[model samples]
Target: MAGSAEGFKEFATSCSGRLFRTAWLLTGDWHLAEDLVQETLGKVYRAWTKRSRPDDPVAYARTTLVRTFITHRRRRGSAERPSDALPDLPAGETDVALRVTLIDTLARLDAKDRAVLVLRYWEDRSVDETAAELGLSAGAVRSRSFRALDRLRAVLGTDGLTPTTQNEVS
Candidate 1:
């Protein structure tokens, strides 16, 4: 698969789950996350056919996912709604409550802030990488990251997911 020019199916198959997790973090809606993943894959597939392969396809997919999510958020009709859609958990999982609270807090954030936080923290990208993906200055990304974390701390502080637990999740 490594040498195949038609390797996008393999690439997409391997990376789509990771892409969907980031998308879900960004959008906080199951259906929207799936749509965002499909769109990111479509873009990657086009690039895979028409251009040279990315040196780092995982990074490329994550950038595409973040940009697509921000683009979708810019549309007037693309507002996120909580769905009954929940990720399937393993049996006897006790951490669902914290996860739910965290996602709900994330969903309350502004779109760009949420993007910044997801890329910088959840994906563990460097400041420069996150700024590049979101098309922001390094200073801007830094500012947003600080403020977004503050917002998360504020909301999650009162929502039973404290700073320590949140840090662990991060």
Candidate 2:
């Protein structure tokens, strides 16, 4: 029991930042990302003893994070309207504006589609791995990837965003 507890602590320390970054990209809110990361770590810790390998702890944690995000979105119901109020932005000009805009566009997508994008592009997971992680078939992943890319292109438009590869879309 003590050994498992120590192992979980080490895993948490090592994977928390990467997990938080992924969560941030998914949610677009730092506080929400922190909360999601904390919840995911707690769940991972609970399963630590049962987990077989230490080397892929990050993968385990990431899968947990994605599942948690999906579950949370489902519970919230995608139909709930976002509030009109916007948070104040900092006064500095930045090169990441387009990236932030892209993220905002991603937020407009369905939770599963957003997860597909993150797993495929940000995490650079192969279609097979993403399908396994999401409990989806490879064909489903490919279909969703195509639809999601089309939606992103429609929402963000083709001008400002660089053209996505056909392979990426398909």
Candidate 3:
């Protein structure tokens, strides 16, 4: 009741930013990322009463956000059309050029490839853990991880958009 509500509030407050970062990487669009985070939080809240809350609600929320992004991408309107002009980066965002390059590269990737990369590298998740989250075999995760990185390297090199240091961006 009240206790459950309070716990959820705290969890959401602490985890929402992390979840939104994952969502943004998944979506490549801020508005869609916000929607995905809200949807994930709603799902977590709905399940809170039926089962004990996850030991790591942040992990739980991330899984939900990834799955929700996957589902959304399957829908009819989810295919994005390329735009000529880049959207303005959020104010005070650091590493503007690097972030823009990463987001652009990520957007070019297939949804599953992007998901595998984000989970494995961006989140620094283990192969087995990412496999479990995406319901793939560990071998599959490994293969995808290799291919995704190779693609990024190829693209960055050809475009001359390589960052000095590759940081695991949110």
- For each candidate in turn, the TM-score is 0.44, 0.42, 0.45
Single out the weakest 10-residue window by summed lDDT for candidate 3. Answer: 159-168
lDDT string for model 2 (92-124, tens) is: 544466677778988999999999988988788
Error of 1 at 39 (Å): 0.3
Off by over 4 Å in 2: 1-3, 51-55, 77-170
Model 2: which residue pairs collide?
Answer: none
Candidate 3: list runs displaced more than 4 Å.
1-3, 80-170
Of candidate 2, the 10-residue stretch with the lowest lDDT total is 161-170
- Counting clashing residue pairs in each candidate, in order, gives 0, 0, 0
The candidate with the higher TM-score, 2 or 3, is 3
- Writing each residue's lDDT as its tens digit, candidate 3 over 1-170 gives 22288888998898899898888887789999999999999998877755666766777878888899999999998887778999997555467676788789999998999999889877889999999999999999999988887888787675443333455255
